[model samples]
Target: MNEREKGGVPDDALIRMTLAGDDGAFGELVERYKGRAFAVAVGIVGDGDDALDVVQDSFIKAYYKLKEFRFGSNFYTWFYRLLVNQAIDRWRKSARSAEVPFDESWLAEDSSPPDGFAYPRTPENLARDRELGDALQRAVDALPEYHRAVIVLREVDGMAYDEIAKVLGCSVGTVMSRLHYARGKLRETLKSHREG
Candidate 1:
């Protein structure tokens, strides 16, 4: 068994081990984050195949740039900067209006209505969920790239504002602004969908 797989080795330790010539330590990091990375990538790029390429490229770039990673800081935050940038670049290149799949489970998050209403297990409610999901997908796809990145990083990935600022290389206020704008746009789209 690899040293990283043995127990609760911290990310910093794995990074140090990787720097000391243990490739497997880096592999452990990849295994730890790849799923979330793929999800973020897909959210940004709006295509699974493009998201995969972005994730792979981001990992390769992160591997080569490991020497630049600052100690005493979160690795995932640094890595996500690269991942988000790659996804945005891919999205810009393609400019495709592909549908990004929305996870219905997110509806259960704190973003739910203030009334604490839950959709019951009825055919009508299920149909409404599907419609909502589709509207959300379209709304997300319509956001500008940076706004989309902010929404995906903040909402979908549940990242803190400061962490998102770090990843996006912007101020916390900027992150808040972008998030507000993105959320406003999404809310407008969804509201129109429901009312119509």
Candidate 2:
């Protein structure tokens, strides 16, 4: 029985219900954020199968650890941090293994075709934007893991600076500074690609 099935209350109410042993309340949280959480894992791991595993495991971890969850902190913030950690671990394992089957085709099906979601109308603009997007991805991947995490959470995820501070267990100023530096590097990398 979902809240939607019964005309819901606030998310915090659902959390309280789940804490009080209503299994459906936890299901509501899962159903709501599963897609976004999976997408975040995929974006970091760059592998569909691994992303799925990460999402499932992260959710299980969250559920068992719910008692430790403090009120006033965003649930998604904790979830995102867990997803990022799982992706990093998978990335490290894939790096060390020689026969892990590296192919972009699977990622391609999940990622996009050339015209998937871009705003370009002209062929030339389309090509240029794609070049920038590819360059941006490469630059982002090259960043230190923590720097990359902060930039993606702040810039890409559009999480508030305070939220990111909580997620990363850092001060808001630290989050801002990391994001500033990461964006500067991305800009420099992109400029060289476009100009040359």
Candidate 3:
């Protein structure tokens, strides 16, 4: 068994060991964060393939810059910032290209809708539900980068405001303001659909 598992080492300790040449420590760190990191990436970039690339690129960048990480701060927050920034950068770079639409197939396979409204199995209900989901995704995709980042981190990833502030390199107030603005925009965009 790996020393990390045997010792129940903290992230900081694992990081220190990784920097000191114990490669398995870094693997442990990756194992611990991979799911959250991938989710953060997918939230920003919107495409599974692009999100996967962002996660890989972020990890590679983190590995090289581990020594520069501040010792006292949360490692996950620091890594989250890296992952978020990489995903945003990728999104910006691909802005001109045809965006690969956000895939919602996993939502059905993995669990019920976030709203928990189980639509009847009729074809019309299923079609309308799919349409609504697509519309919501488009509304989110339309948000400006800063607002989108805050919304995804807070709502999609269930990050606390302070945690998001840390990951976004901003104050909690900024995170709140951005989230409010993003939510307002989404409301405006989806209002007509709801009324109809």
Candidate 4:
């Protein structure tokens, strides 16, 4: 059984139950979305610990704001809006404070690259691939916050344009524009890195 089936309640039903004073219903919501939320958060904040904080804070905010949620809308989209905004804010604060260290540990953990390519078997190729991955990540980090969000939401999460537009509180056109600009910038940065 899927999680919702196992829980025996849909998200709206769970929200209603929570509104009726069943805290467990809300807990189920958290359990359902926390992993995906963390992935999105990490993609934006680029730091696992900060991403954790962002997820926790977003959940807490979501809990308090549950009453404001319009029934029948996708709960994840609403929650994702909060999560993305929180991540961007956190990223901005960290960026302004000092250099935010890029964590390469995630790179090591995944056997394949984010682009779905298998890692090179040879040691030399592996090292070069690692360098390319590092450069790509650094290029992504250098993107503006909204551009980063757009790229991560589209590329990493594979969210549809309309869904991303909803999450980012932008029009579909804006989402497309940001994504185009972000990709162009990354290409330019990576090209310069290669040529240099």
Candidates' C-alpha lDDT: 0.90, 0.74, 0.83, 0.86
Task: Give the poorly placed runs of model 4, Cα more than 4 Å off.
Answer: 1-8, 95-120
The estimated TM-scores of all candidates read: 0.88, 0.76, 0.85, 0.84
Candidate achieving the largest TM-score:
1
Where model 3 places Cα greater than 4 Å from the true spot, the runs are 1-3, 96-122
How does model 2 fare in lDDT?
Answer: 0.74
Off by over 4 Å in 1: 1-3, 102-118
* Arranged by lDDT, best first: 1, 4, 3, 2
lDDT of 3 by residue, 1-196 (tens): 9666686789999999999999888888888888888877877787778888999999989999999998999999999999899988998988542333534464455666558676555668667767777777787778888888888898888999999998999999999899999999999888977887
Give the root-mean-square deviation of each candidate in angstroms: 3.4, 5.5, 2.9, 3.4
Q: Candidate 2 at 103: error in angstroms? A: 16
Which digits, one per residue and each the tens of the lDDT, describe model 2 over residues 1-196?
Answer: 9556774666677678889999888898888788877766655665568878988988888888888877887788877777778777876677632122333343343556466565435657556656666677777777776677788777656789998788778899999999898899989998889788
- If both were scored by TM-score, which would come out higher, candidate 1 or candidate 3? 1
The TM-score of candidate 3 is 0.85
User: How many residue pairs clash (N, CA or C atoms closer than 3 angstroms) in each of the candidate models, in the order given?
Assistant: 0, 0, 0, 0
**What lDDT would candidate 4 get against the real structure?**
0.86
Residue runs of model 2 more than 4 Å from their true location after superposition: 1-3, 6-8, 96-120
Model 4, span 1-196: residue lDDT tens: 8666587688999999899998989999999899989888888888888989999999999999999999989998999999999999999888442223444554465546658666656768656666777677787888889999999899978899999999999899999999999999989988987898
